[model samples]
Target: MRTSLSVHDLSFTWPDGSTVVTGLDLAIGPGRHGLVGLNGSGKSTLLKLVAGQLTPTTGTVTTAGTLAYLPQDPGSDPRRTIAEVLAIADTLAALSRMEAGDVRESDYDVIGDDWDIAERTAAELGRLGLGHLELDRTVATLSGGELVLLSLAALLLRRPAVLLLDEPTNNLDGEARARLIEAVAGWRGTLLVVSHDRALLNAMDDIAELRGGEVRWYGGGFDAYEAQVAAEQEAAERAVRAAETDVKAQKRDLVESQAKLASHARQGRARAARGDLPRILVGGRKRAAQVTAGRVTGVHQERLAGAASRLDEAEAAVRDDREIRVDLPDTAVPPRREVLLLEGVRPAFGDLELDLDVRGPERIGLTGRNGAGKTSLLRTITGELAPAGGRIEMKVPWRYLPQAMDLLVPELTVAENIARIAPDASETERRSRLARFLFRGRDADQPASTLSGGERLRATLASLLLAEPAPQLLLLDEPTNNLDLPSIRHLVEALRSYEGAFIVVSHDERFLDDLELTRRIQV
Candidate 1:
């Protein structure tokens, strides 16, 4: 197939005064393309530009055929069922053919009737793992992950020439994400995908990195790009060191030359006073030497300036444009035994039981089909929900980190929020604690709402830990959803080191496996 989508010098700025994407040029053909960058780098914005959901302020985006976008958050589209939603594309096509009367009698024999099309559409839904899903189930009732998968199925039904996906793996489990990726990889059409999953990027033909309102294309895998970035950083560090050394050497030479010039002037004055025979000649020589010394000083200054320029470039290169530092406050708590216990706890909501028994030191993974009450069960354990019939006992102080980072006040600055959370601590003490969590100086003044998803998570965790009574039990729901790989690793390390019990719900298999889960509770 030929290239289906092309974007040239595309730029967009929101009315609220943020240039999300600028001077971006991209050419997409038939192979899978990966869009990898830090959050708010405009990956989603670029996709929106291509899909025509957002207009560009400059340049143009052109598509040869039909286009579709599967948004990261497939907002509530409630009138369709899982199966009906997937079949909409086929239904639309069939209706068009009937209204146009373009299907001749002979064409009907070859193309099959409306019933045949509907039957095959239903079959296709089954292949995509929605076979059991009722054709009449409302989209509103599905979980966030289920909605994402269903949206993909709907996109496939349309059979567009180009597909733009924004974090399609957002709410999906390991298996679902893998299946969705495999299906897209096998697709014959063009694909542009935005994802933070490093493993997924390895399967792409090329990657595009967005930073500072610019997009850089790398014609290699994730590993190659990472290696290149690392080397650049090392080179930058060396340049900085060399610049510092040159500055010091230049300053020392300047000091020595000034001293000699001063001594020479003093000697000339002595010779004049003595009225020595060759005083004039000595003056001429001194004048010539002074000119030469001045030229040498200028040369040294120029060389120092050159060194500074190189150092600047090196600093830019070593900045590691995509790096994000997430720090959580250090919390000290007394050792505890049996943080939480659930004995044959059959928590039910509307006659449907969600979870069974759960114990401490046991890593319980909640997994099931959507609407199987995974989240409901977690809420019950965290006291967010009142269980109808189950018994839950808690022995230690606990803290809950919701999936949405809802605990953070959106309007408050990072430092102010921290101070508010720990009201007993002084400003200096609060700032010191926040500094350990990497919210230093001006950074602490940025409102929590403006923070990146990872940053918000870090700030939230830091505030929770800095409370008067640190939590001994940490309950996290979908902890790794929007976090980058490095942030996720840091969080895992922090949790591992804490002398506290943890219960987390996530769909990432590799994450779960890497953390060495003790046991899995299928809800």
Candidate 2:
């Protein structure tokens, strides 16, 4: 196979002597490869190095063809239009056409004799779903999702040999994400993608994992990688358990040896102190015994130290395999006739009717295409925005979990947040409530700012339950946005058991299917 790119003995160390990449080697020829790893695992760093944006500290990276990168967040000039950005990708092609002396006097009257190139760019734009966007409109007017779509369209228009994408599906809705994946899959060039999207990874030819500054290539796609990871994790766990057993045995043996050596030394000393033996002979024997005991003691100590080090290494492996848990409080929500009423709840935007009829004990899912105003409807339901011609009446307790997860106070301790959100509770009661939510002891003392994404969600749910009256209505907007697979699974399990009325807005098909919402409203 021809090598499009090669890296040999690639090693890099930050200024702090920490190895981010060491003795790493990779070779890729014209095919799709998916890179998967945990957050902060140097996936982005490696991509930057591959893009020639950063030089390797101690190794060489040589590329045979031109490379282009699309970052997770595209930085587009606000003053440029979609067409202009697309044209940027065709600069070389346009220049080549300009140099060919193909300009006709009549053709100049239309697209200045470059009408062919412009037409090609226009077609590419339409293919990528930016056909409606004005070519001269400022990029600032585009939403975050729109920016990503336009950026990918521009890069593909360039027609480079290799394409690099970082979390391209993160901000995209389901339809857009599907379209982007299809575009990449149809392309006949080398592609390296760093994403957590399982579906996208499954579309690749191979999967590679970056862990502890090293890479392991799997023969198949995401499923193969997952199996390999599971096997490795199981092996590591067994090693940890075995090491702990050996360490415990070693500790007991060391203690026994030390005690025996002390006993021997004492006997030797007593024999030397006796006047019954020839003085020289007694002294020599005592010295001999002492030397032997000292040697044995030193050996035992060395063995103990080795065992301790092995135990530490095993413990580290256990820590790495540990999964983050998301456990929320289980509150009592009384069965109500009508928790909230959204009658004729016309939204502030969009062409949809302001009429939405909902009753208690219903799990409703709001689904729609991108820019369908799902979030706007959510805001209106939460009373953050007043509808132009609708009414929302709450007959029972209610709370809203916005997509931002801003319910918890970042500056305060989790315990403090619980207390602040429920001021009528006593200190003991607040602590007890937090404990029930799996934030017991020192965990409760952690600042909300220090929580992981899953932990923050749990904290918010705990606070709501701790209120004087448990909320009968629960509204969640994209609650699974930043969660990992396991966290999402845990949330689905919890919601399955929840008794309150639920209304969720999400574009995740898997999540919605698992939720088994009773009603689907497309905005």
Candidate 3:
């Protein structure tokens, strides 16, 4: 019943004069709350402000008890040991020094009540599926999933009353993500998480949507919020229809009033010509009619204006984050052609060894545990790494989309990125293809550095898929790792129409299901 975290009239602006959040207010109670928004909608910025990592331009934040934060990136250094990363190495060393008879007052001060620190650390790590990970092990040796779990283990060990996690599952594989979800489900303290993972959001006690500089509350999980949005949109659309009808009615009334005024004028002219009344009386009568007609016309015009304004307001309430809608007839694959063959090949970089054959239009789902080399196998298939043994035979043109999405040149615009890949294609042709990915008009001219995470990925994918010679076989590595839900959905929808064979490595089960995979390969 009590509020644990509070944000009051918070506002933040970048150095470039871009305002990301403005006059935002939110109160989070003691529960697992999911914070969601579009990629560039300032969800992470709000968390950073709440965690005191960034000072808001105005207003204040207050927490009921001790607070801790787990950032999206986690700021992990590969060369540092787990203890060092957790920021407890110095305290542990002080305790060791005291036991070694240093007898320093500072050592005693630092190690005062934390005598059980080591035991607590081990217990927390084990609880989070990190018991096998040693405190002295460097982060460099850990896989992406392990690194994420280790970071979370550090947060759990602190036992803070309030915990803030931003995109905690950014690059985690399914196993690591499940471990986090389990940990979240057991949280007893106030927890606010900003994540794009629907599965993670589904585990929350409530969902908060931050949009247009405001936070809107919804009870329960992602499904509940979606239902609420659907209802709200339905009402908004209905208001639009009513407003449109009112405008039409007002226009018709004005037209009828004008016709009557014109007929009255004609009758007055005939009376004046026939000298049916005194000149003075006729002039006064004409002036009165003109005045009345003007008043009537102005009244109708005002009503029409009000109706048009209402229609605009109604339309504004409707959300227009349109999905990518484009036809890719050329990307479709036939059902009976040989796509690729791999014979007893060991990757030079990863620990995976494989023997496989892929046929036309086959959508292969590649999966494995972290460190099992899902990415390395894809790299090897793309000739980025040599096979230690055996051979890879590609029966058709191939293209590889890596996990990092580094295909685009940072200085190039979306249109330019596509143009670089398809040098012979005309500018018009290149733009048409990019438009299919939702990059239209000036959006296609935005530099790669300026795009949001989702936009950049879409641009990079557009570039690869629209190459000079259309690729028949596509190799994708961890494609769903960092993509937001909408971007993931866009990709899934696009791939549905793709005729080319694709081998994709993704830990998102939801994404895998949406792809309607033709075959599955476990590395």
RMSD of each: 5.0, 6.8, 3.1
> Model 2, which residues run further than 4 Å from truth?
1-29, 42-67, 73-85, 88-147, 171-175, 212-216, 262-280, 318-339, 354-364, 383-388, 394-502, 513-523
lDDT of 3 by residue, 269-367 (tens): 999999999999999999999999999999999998999999999999988765665465666667788889999889765678899889878999998
- lDDT (10s digit) by residue, model 1, range 97-169: 7668876555444345444556666666665666667766888677777777777877876678988988778
| Winner by lDDT | 3
* Per-residue lDDT of candidate 2, residues 14-38 (tens digit): 4434456888999988899998765
Give the C-alpha lDDT of model 3.
Answer: 0.83
Which window of ten consecutive residues has the lowest lDDT sum in model 1?
A: 321-330
Instruction: Give each model a TM-score.
Output: 0.80, 0.68, 0.88
Which candidate number would show the highest TM-score if scored against the true structure?
3
Give the runs in model 1 whose Cα sits over 4 Å from its true position.
1-3, 8-19, 52-59, 77-80, 87-120, 234-283, 321-330, 347-373, 407-452, 459-463, 466-470, 493-499, 513-523
Residue 471, model 1: lDDT of: 72
Error of 2 at 265 (Å): 4.6
Candidates ranked, most accurate by TM-score first: 3, 1, 2
Model 3 ranges off by over 4 Å: 1-9, 13-18, 49-67, 92-106, 109-112, 274-278, 326-332, 348-351, 410-419, 422-432, 441-447
Task: Point out the higher-scoring one by lDDT: 1 or 2.
Answer: 2
